[model samples]
Target: MTFNPYLAGLKTNAAEPGKGSSGNIERPQAVGNIPWQTRPAELTAFEMTLADALQAMFRDGVETLPDIVARLNASTVQHPEGSWTEQNYQSLMNRLAAGASV
Candidate 1:
């Protein structure tokens, strides 16, 4: 959260700084962050980049997690963090499903 210069002063409108800091921690979307660990990143970019590929595969009638995993592993898609495993892919899907808008 400290990395975002834009969000430098975007703290809760606390009655007092020290006291307000005691509230439950919250964070904006952790999507396509550039200077990592900060404000809401460009989630749409992240989504569309991956979604486009997935959509194409689905349109081609690809189904099942195993198949998807195999295709992703074999495809030319390059995840910023590296290769995809079944577990990591499933976890990512879960994160996307949680609240990621189209």
Candidate 2:
């Protein structure tokens, strides 16, 4: 599975309707722009090692799929502002599934 650096950096601020001191203010645009000055390259060796360890755990049936998902969700919650997303989840799952069949 391919990695998406863009999705890794995706962030959104909730739009709220309010007034400064008078009337209702306009809703802000839902822009998909990444706030980073520059996008970084591929994952580093440590990151790859971590990913590999997780993948191996999945591949070896060390944990059930649900357990893995739960752990991932917990991780996302613990690091809410970090670079984990649905795309990353799918990619990791796909890779693990493919590895399992091999």
Candidate 3:
């Protein structure tokens, strides 16, 4: 089995409703048996890229907790196919405060 980005995107959105769709209904899907714990670096880099892209997209310069959270939320909404959630955003903010990247 192999990883299908389309199916993964669908699964991500399915895990949480109201996030919208990925528009891959007719695409042939691939299945995979990869372990979640085996992808830390990949996941982290992906998240970092997503956060950076989101920041670039809405760059007014973050100055406060509320502002950061709002921007994160907007980014999550914008990229509904990614693994962004309220908890993940909070964790990212905590990591940032602790001098770490997403």
Candidate 4:
């Protein structure tokens, strides 16, 4: 499949891929063949953006916490406190997961 910006689901299209043939970019409904899951409404905007940035970092093979924090600091996505530290990363993850029953 061709690279599509809509496939990321960050942008909505009039008609998504496999739903029609408007000749616009084809946004696949799944990632790695798994159906896309809806994000929880409880997550704040900062959390959502942070999650996206972390997802991109993981896809690029940045696994270590320090490295991830460093990359996040270097990127435009600022942490809620202005910068990401290993400590804050852990704290935020814990906080985000605290209310998550799943």
Off by over 4 Å in 3: 1-43, 54-59, 77-90, 95-102
Q: Best-fitting candidate, measured by lDDT?
A: 4
**Candidate 2 local Cα displacement, residue 65, angstroms:** 11
lDDT of 1 by residue, 1-102 (tens): 323443445555354333224563333342333364443334566566787879988998888888887787777775556887778787777866564333
- For candidate 3, write residues 1-102 as lDDT tens digits: 222343332346564344445753422233323444223223455556666765775676665556655665665444333544666666765765454434
By TM-score, is 1 or 4 better? 4
lDDT of each candidate versus the true structure: 0.62, 0.47, 0.50, 0.66
Model 1: residues >4 Å from true position, as ranges? 1-42, 100-102
Query: Candidate 3 vs candidate 4: which has greater TM-score?
Result: 4
Candidate 1's error at 43, in angstroms? Answer: 3.2
lDDT of each residue in 1-102, candidate 4, tens digit only: 223333354555453444334566434563233233333234556766888999999999999988998999999888767677899878878876654411
Q: Compare candidates 1 and 3 on lDDT and give the better one.
A: 1
| Candidate number that wins on lDDT, 2 or 3 | 3
Cα error of candidate 3 at position 94, Å: 3.9
Best by TM-score: 4
The per-residue C-alpha lDDT of model 2 at residue 99 equals 35
